[model samples]
Target: MQINTIYTRSVIQTMAGKAIRDLRSGGERELRNVAELCKGCSASPGYQTFWSLLENILRRPDQQYAALLSRAANDVDINCLKTLIANLGLHAYPNGSQPLPGTRESGTSPSYWMEPLDDIMDPRMLHQQISRLQKQGTSSFLFRAGQKPELETILNIAGKHRQCVFFLICGAESCCRAYLEEMTALGNVIPLMEYETLAPTAASLKQAGILFGLHRRYCEIESLQAEENLLRQCIALGCFLGVYEGSAQCPSQNWELACYSRLQEMRCNGAQEIFLADLWRDREAVQKLLEQRSGQV
Candidate 1:
């Protein structure tokens, strides 16, 4: 099985490299043409809204940043990109939207925590579980737990389902050169690593054509400026998204609102995506806060 997996990844890496090269050669004309095709597909508001957001992002005044996003888009697998834009788009833009092709409404989030697979558990069993989840509309899986070897197994399984994205949350040590190569080869797995750890390898990751995000835990005492600075640093580091997980110790209502306020500020900036890990926990309160804030604007 391992041998077959290695062979499969080798083939995928070659194909993916060709795809990136093809996309790079095509440049913005191809991307814009694809966007136009999407716009022509459905006159539905959802399609219009999604394409608008994508177009706006692509048209940002910061050409360097915009080009970086454009190149990142080209680098990511189409299925993975659809899964990301579909799942993250809904949260990032809470109003009327439609799930992109090959995406579905996952119940607890397309992203979730899965325990490391034990020796007794057939790796196929996890694949079956993932298949079931995909059937039920879960487009992404967050393997927030597990080590290098364990993650490799999960990535192998997750790679089988191209329509879904599996995120491997790791630290700097875990996200070393070889591991990143393995992930880049896999084509469907993304690294969501510690925010602080991103600096050392951020440039290399971008150069390697890997799309990665940051996982940050915020506390009650963290000032808004501090959070803003961290977010700016994250964007500058070529982070695709910022996963803001609130510290359990700071679960007070006021603290949560404050955190969301800071998050919303960054979200409005339109530089990088921001996801609130515990948003559902305070769904009602946060929804109201977002609504009120949006109205005030």
Candidate 2:
């Protein structure tokens, strides 16, 4: 169903009003009403808009609404605002004409500053920083090595960027790798994949139209065999490759098995490795495959 912006805004405004009213007085009844309102509101058109508006209202120091705002902000489903509030604190929301101490009227909050890790290398402090960043929608940050001050400076910069993607670039060493692996598992960091040079295969040559004529390029036997094999593997893993388009497309028995048989015979005869990237270029198809793997579809 398609919903216009005006209608969606109206719904959000109505929901926000009801939520605020509930927060002001009614107990269990109000909670139920707010939940109902939330359910009715469409999250499609403007999830962030609704959240920001609600957060701004809740940031007021009024004791009556503070508890409700806190509770709502902490809710797992709508916790995005919690990150903003955590970083901005009380200064995020101002009182009428007067602005909060740490915040400027321009609405730009100051960056968080951190001490040098060399001077105060507390694991607990690193954990806390990582936790705060995760909540703030940051995904990744770069970590340098050798120069202690440079690493410390980068951490401080990263704490404020709120980037949702991070890449750690340090010297390749056992200690660095160990530390990075630990941090990645803890959701504090993401390690970059090691570089590897790939050698071109028969499949790659065929793909470049070198092995087959232009008209028969897509009909390359080895390339087709490799794709079919990968598709079969995906299916065996409970993945659906969606509908296939061809004159010989079968609908009765599982096509995965049929494809696998073709691939196995070709591989036995020395077929080349198929580039994973070449087999899956459609984003929608890739997304569906991921969802299927994760049991989302």
The local distance difference test score of each candidate is 0.54, 0.32
RMSD (Cα, Å) for all candidates, in order, is 9.2, 21.4
- Most TM-score-accurate candidate: 1
lDDT of 1 by residue, 76-144 (tens): 555444444433323223232222222124443222212223442357777887766554434556666
Off by over 4 Å in 1: 1-37, 41-44, 53-68, 71-122, 247-252, 271-297
Predicted structure with the largest lDDT when compared to the true one:
1
- Report how far off residue 214 is in candidate 2 (Å): 34
Residue 100 alpha-carbon offset, candidate 2, angstroms: 16
Q: Mark the regions of model 2 whose C-alpha exceeds 4 Å error after superposition.
A: 1-140, 145-166, 174-177, 193-297
lDDT for residue 200 in candidate 1, whole number 0-100:
88
Candidate 2 C-alpha error for residue 105, in Å: 6.2
TM-score of 2: 0.21
